[model samples]
Target chain A: MSVIILAVFAAVMILLLVGLTRALKSPSTGFARSFAVVAMVLLPSVWLLAMLVYADSEMKKVSFCTSCHEMKPYGESLHVDDDESLSASHYQNNRVDKTKACYVCHTEPGLLGYMDAKLRGLHDVRVHYFGKAPEELELVAPYDNAVCLKCHGEAKSFLEGGGHQYPDTLIDALKAGEMSCLDCHDLAHHLED
Target chain B: MVSPFQLFPTGPEATTRVLKRGVVAQILGILVLAGALFTKMPLLMVVIIPVGALLIALGILAWVWAVVWADAG
Candidate 1:
């Protein structure tokens, strides 16, 4: 997909260059004027839109998130040898798609959640470049149980687990958001402070 | 009696000026877009891409304006 976008961009750029040169050389020519309009206006608009789509897809990758220096520790933590680390366990065990591990866990479940995640990404970019990056990364809000339940809620292991069964209302509380999944399974990332 | 200039200014000079401005803007936009695409960095994605697109949009508008309001000849 990215390769295709790059190819299209290159083609448009070549066409644009040709059009501009011709138009500038002979502004009186009708063919040059028409070709210039198509090259400059139509081709570029389409290419820009395609680039946007490519960027959106690329941003979902784990590599993209870890590209920033501050995020390197978090990315490394995913590969930590500890089974107790939530991120590491999920990543190593293939619980989530490794390529999009960051996005899958961080983003909420619906369209609004997806948009919110993208907005937060923009904020992260702003802070990363314009503002001072904090020494420690933290979530803007408390981690929601809903994000966890989206996957584990229906699992038989989760439903019939002895620990959860011991306290019957525990599952209910977790479902109702009264209790957080992180309350017990808090080893989200084993970052070295 | 409505003058031709009053109805639609068909000056070749004005057309050339607008076309030049549009072409310059388009070139700048394409360069910026290419740079962003090459790097594929978050900063480029967040800041540069939109700015480049905006420049192109403005350029296109200018080109259209030149074509519609100014003399091609």
Candidate 2:
């Protein structure tokens, strides 16, 4: 898909070069003017929009998130051998798509959630470039239980777990955001010391 | 009643100048867009794409204005 978009962009740019050159040489010519409009204006508008969409999709991949030096440890954390590590467990066990592992856990589902994640991603890029990066990375906000419940809320192991069943209201508390899954399952990412 | 000439004074020099500006903008926009697309970096997403799009839009507007003026001439 990336290759295809790049190929189409190259073709459009070549056409634009030809049209713009002709239009510049003969600004009074009707055919050249029209060709310039189609090549320089219309084709590029469509292609730029396509590129934005492609960029958004690319940002959802783990590789995109982990491209920065600060994010390398988090990416490596996904491969930790420990089963207790939330990211590693989910990644190694195929709970989420490997290509989009970071996005799956970080982004809430739905349009607003997706937009919020993208905005945060932009902020991250800003901080990475212009501001100080912390020695240890932290979430901007507490990890929401809702993200976990989206998948685990109905899972057999989660529902049948002794800790959830013992208090009876534990599940409801979790659902209502009164309890955090991390309280018990705290080894979210065991980064190497 | 405003004549089209009053609204968009047409001369070969004016057409050439405006068209040159438009072409320059389009070329710059294309370069920026190409850089963003090829790099696929998050920084480029924030910085490059918007700048490229703006340049392209300005170019399109200039080209249209030049075309209209040229036709009137």
Candidate 3:
């Protein structure tokens, strides 16, 4: 009986081994296959989350608005300029978080907006790589009505500075075809001396 | 019982390898790139680690194909 039991135990272990191999084998496939499927499912989620967080800001907040690398220096200028300067309008406002990052204000909302921003970004990258951008990049923030409407479109009173000190003439002018917010609020934060 | 490992003769094999490893390697590469994006791993995509791995797998397949199906007849 002991001899038969030993044989049976060996047979069971062999059967388990064979079962695992058979399950793993897909003609030539292996256990490595499952890992790929899992990885593919995960990457886009992180990218999407990053986009959603940054999307809340206005479109002009894109780093390219004030300049590529120039914007950081401009943002740093705010701390030096202090709140007293007219340059400190929306940026250094007492209640608002002034240290918000570059993309927070520049990019748009949702996946399509991110794609749009990235497409524009490709152009900027090409320009930068080819040495087309000037040493001091232009402050061409496209403060269109759609951009301002992101924060103020719903409230008619907010557009008139009822509860908000933020500029709304931008939305009004954009609607009226007069001008845009970037015409004056041009720099990333504000320009230095 | 015949040894399963010896199912094929040890003589010269065919020289016409089909390059299926390229397909596997390509898929693994895309998954790795996706993983890098997911995990916030820096220099993963920039270094083209995914493509590099795929290339290595493809190279291995090419070598195997050469050994197995190398028109040496």
**Each model's TM-score, in the order given?**
0.78, 0.80, 0.46
What are the chain A TM-scores of the candidates, in order?
0.80, 0.83, 0.48
lDDT tens digits, residues A40-120, model 1?
788878877776676677789999999999999999999889999999999999999999999999998889889989899
Q: Give the Cα error of residue A30 in candidate 2, in Å.
A: 5.7
| Steric clash pairs (candidate 2) | none
Which pairs clash in the backbone of model 1?
none
Error of 3 at A35 (Å): 8.3
- Count of clashes in candidate 3: 9
* Residue A188 shift from truth in candidate 2, angstroms: 1.0
Best DockQ goes to which candidate?
A: 2
Docking class of 3: incorrect
Estimate, for each residue in B1-73, the C-alpha lDDT of model 2 and write its tens digit.
Answer: 9877777657767777787788778778877876766785788777877898899888888877888755665
For all predictions in the order shown, the interface RMSD in Å is: 2.1, 1.9, 13.9
The TM-score of predicted model 1 comes to 0.78
Candidates, ranked, TM-score:
2, 1, 3
lDDT of 3 by residue, A1-193 (tens): 3354335334433433343233223313334233222222222233223323323232234232444453556665556555543335545553234444344345565687667766665566566556466777653555444544565566667555543344545555655648654455444445565
Top TM-score model: 2
lDDT for model 1 comes to 0.82
